[model samples]
Target: MERLHKLFIYRKKLVRPYIEQLLKWMDIITYVMSALLIMTLVYEHGFLISFQEIGVINRLYHIVWVVFLVDTTLHLLLNYSDTRRKYRGLAWLLSVMLYLTLIPVVFHEPEIQGGIHTFWAFFNSRLYHVILLTLLSLLQLSNGIVRLLGRRTNPSLIFASSFLIFILIGAALLMLPRATYHGISFIDALFTATSATCVTGLVSVDVSSTFTPEGLFIIIMLIQIGGLGVMTLTSFFAMFFMGNTSLYNQLVVRDMVSSQSLSSLLSTLLYILGFTLAIEAAGMGIIFLGIHGTMDMTVREELAFSAFHSISAFCNAGFSTLPGNLGNEMVMHGHNTIYITISFLIILGGIGFPILVNLYETVTYEVKRIWHHYIKGNKRMRRKIHLYNLNTRIVLIMTAILLIVGTVVIVVLEWNNAFAGMSPTDKWVQAFFNATCPRTAGFSSVGMTTFSMQTLLLMVILMMIGGGTQSTAGGVKVNVFAVVMLNLRAILIGADKVTIFNRELSHDSIRRSNATLILYLLVVFAGIFSLSLLEPQASIMALVFECTSALSTVGSSLDLTPTLGSDSKLIIIILMFVGRVGVLTLMSSIIKQKKITKYRYPSDNIIIN
Candidate 1:
């Protein structure tokens, strides 16, 4: 009795104080281990198939698979008391999905081929190859989710999760038998998933020839989610159904939208969301009527096609279900309907949302004033209501400049080179569409390879400049480029401050603008340098153009995608992700864990010529 009482007292003394402390330490260690596992997976590069050790590659993949499964199981068991079961359920679901997708690969016999890397040989499976591909894709998604979910709740987590999920679904779909699956290849599927999630339009296979109606529908959905960004869409819906949005969620939406935060961000987002859908619906209606009258499709098919194209176009996803892309139909018929409709859609979508809102408000205010004046028999009405905001003015001005410059350059340079065979009207239309689409829209009326070197260079410049912020379009953004140029001009003129359209810039805005410019250039250069090493024989101009297009998420390629090795494709993937999420934010996400000091040190200046 005395021993039992002493033991109970000792247990009581030992348990309570240390439990929470122990848990905290365990959480930290689990996070670190998870991160270390992710890093190992990234660097593994896996075994190549072919050559002497094809079987080895398959065995290695299986080993890695087993390792991940064990790790996942252990994590679930260890965290059972503190962590929610939902996480374990997620891990289980992920594992099941991966194993299910890889079932087809199990039937294939590995064959050794000469000169192939051992890792490549392991990936070799007949029809079952897709199984391995599907498993790898799911792993990526599961890892992304697990990583983000481990962190504190934030809006960025939502974007990261959605992006990963879309890729996983797209990958699994591609792994299905290609014949019944509408000619989809594993590479094409991965590329499409990456492009849509990144909102880059670089396609490995022709979208029109291969994708079934269901597949095309999937592609369109990706375009919409990718273009508007998943976080922005989800947050908008959340705000509509629920009155409140958390600050962390709002921050994620702002980052996704690339907004400047002039007013209540939630209200602005609501307006933008509602307005965007309305515009897209109207656009679909217009295009449907035009296409229905022109083509001989059934009503249901026509409506589906119209809706798909409208959403994709408005979102600037640049995906088309039509055979041979836009260039094909243009070849069949004269450049009359398709070019005009698509061009108009691209133009409207390229304009930033804030500008669209401003334009609507301006027009509505003017119309109301005019109506009131007419009723009272007043003489005049104002032409403009409240001067256009900085964002609006910059977008409009830069857009016009780029269009004019691009048109002139294309006409002058390509007139003799690629445009030699076309009529004057067709040539102009081709040039105009090419120029406009590179900002965001991926439509092409002419072969990319046919363009002159000068024209391609110009395209590189325009693509790097990209479209407006808070718009579906990607790139460095025209507004940022314009601000940088204006600042440079101001400095050259020896002005104390940068001025634009009779308004002085805020110091903070100018600093951010400059930083954005530098960061964008650095990213482009790094992409180009990396790609050049992978394909030494390719022209520097062509490689840079491709890199810029990927960085801009513009989807314009010079026919280099199909021939690129796995290394090059991975590099492009990185560029596309960076392009969608600004370079600044990507960098911040990496460095955010390290808290910076609040105190400022003394500053020093350097002289420049």
Candidate 2:
């Protein structure tokens, strides 16, 4: 040990440079290898590995193991003390774990050799290999994400790029034979991937019939990731577990997650993750209870069905494992509880992360205050009048207004027409669900074609209006809609400033809201025009609904999605991508914004009306 230490220390100047150079090359090699490794696993998942392919898979895994071993060794040798101190010697321990992957290679004893053979058997087991493959790949993926963010890339561009990457990856994964019932075309795969990643429920093919359980899992995974921005999951896991990331990386993540300051970044991430899982779990349970013993499904099937819909509804992705979605006969008629539960889940998810965080804080404060003042009989209790934030207040109000108006309108117009056969209680439940879904949960219980023309118009408006900003749901967002309405109200009422809840709305906020509204309309119109040209056989109203749905990331369709041509599908794909990542966000990412000029143009107003 002393001689080894002396050798490394004595030759530090002579050997350190080469070691450093080797480490750089190894890092590049590791990047390439890690990507290949993941692709290999994906390929294995897509198809049944042949007897011949098994050997090849083993060789590839062994190669990866060797690379990891070398990398870990060099990292330890280069800065032994630093690594030992870092993460409380976690790196050194993981290196030990890596070394254990060679146990089978080290011990070649037969079964009769007792303890040595038993050890060999354990290490040589397929389960160990599988676990190692998964563990290493995840670590690599997390590390790669950290490294990518470490480079000073524009956050918006990174945001767009990451979604594209996931879409492509999902597309490839979906195409795997094992993922699907038979097989699907690349175009269909791409469309499905884009839809899933964008949390838009639109599908060219029926998800229930087209995909195997494996494929559905992949789609759900994409929904979860897409529902939460890509940067969010990667950054949280990488930084929290790995530790010692660059400060710039943390700051970038801080902005992405809407943390008020660096100090609160961790809590914000935790809250976002906690809210997502907890709500989804609760939704799943409620859905399960509502549909229990009704679907002729097994225990496992019931749970899967519940979990899938819960995630889908909360993500507002609109995808459903059921053939006709929530409209399927099993639960559509009398399982009114299911409809109400799903609608509430969609509302919660669409309300935005900021609001969720604000609600959490408010709830916790109230709980603590109540406990201290009432339970503990304390004389003093902390209080805050402005517990709810401005954004939160606006979103809640707009969401409430939209839901009530949508419900009332749908019920008044469709009470006798579309919902003829349903009981009075059932009619109200269906009406409420239908109204709530248009704000964009894509789970349709009633056929779109059966709706009155007036109701369809209302849906179009609601779809375009969409859900809240920084939430899984998409569209112009409730925030922008509220802002624009307030601005208009201010103008009509002869007030210079738009005031709400005793707070004045900023001019910048009004300007941004107007810009978002205009941009959204322009994009939706462009999509409609393109689709009309590509699909001349389709009705103008259907084209309008399709474009609105795609652009708004609302999965509702007028039975027009399956019939669209390839070109039309591509157009919808672009719209879904744009809608999922905000139109403003995509434009800001691509088009460079010139720095603000010191001088401003003379103020002027253009004639209107």
lDDT of 1 by residue, 424-476 (tens): 88778877778888888776667888887778878888888888886788888
Which tens-of-lDDT digit does each residue in 1-609 have in candidate 2? Answer: 999998888899788789779878887787777788888888877788888998998888888878878877777778666555433333445556678878777766585878777777877787776666566556657767867777987788989999999999999999998999989999899999999999999999999999999999999999999998898888776655556677888898888888889888877988899999999999999999988898999989999999999999999999999989888888876688888889999999999898999998899999999999999999676688999989999999999999999999999999999999889898889889999888877889889999999999999999999999899998899999999999989999999889999999988999889999999999999998888888989999999999899988989999999988788899999999999989988999999889988998889999988
Shift in Å, residue 37, candidate 2: 1.6
What TM-score against the true fold does each predicted structure earn? 0.71, 0.93
Give candidate 2's whole-model lDDT: 0.87
Model 2: how far is 268 from its true place, Å?
Answer: 1.9
Question: Each candidate: what lDDT?
Answer: 0.69, 0.87
Error of 1 at 135 (Å): 29
Candidate 2 — worst ten consecutive residues by lDDT sum? 83-92
- Candidate 2: residue 380 Cα off by (Å): 1.8
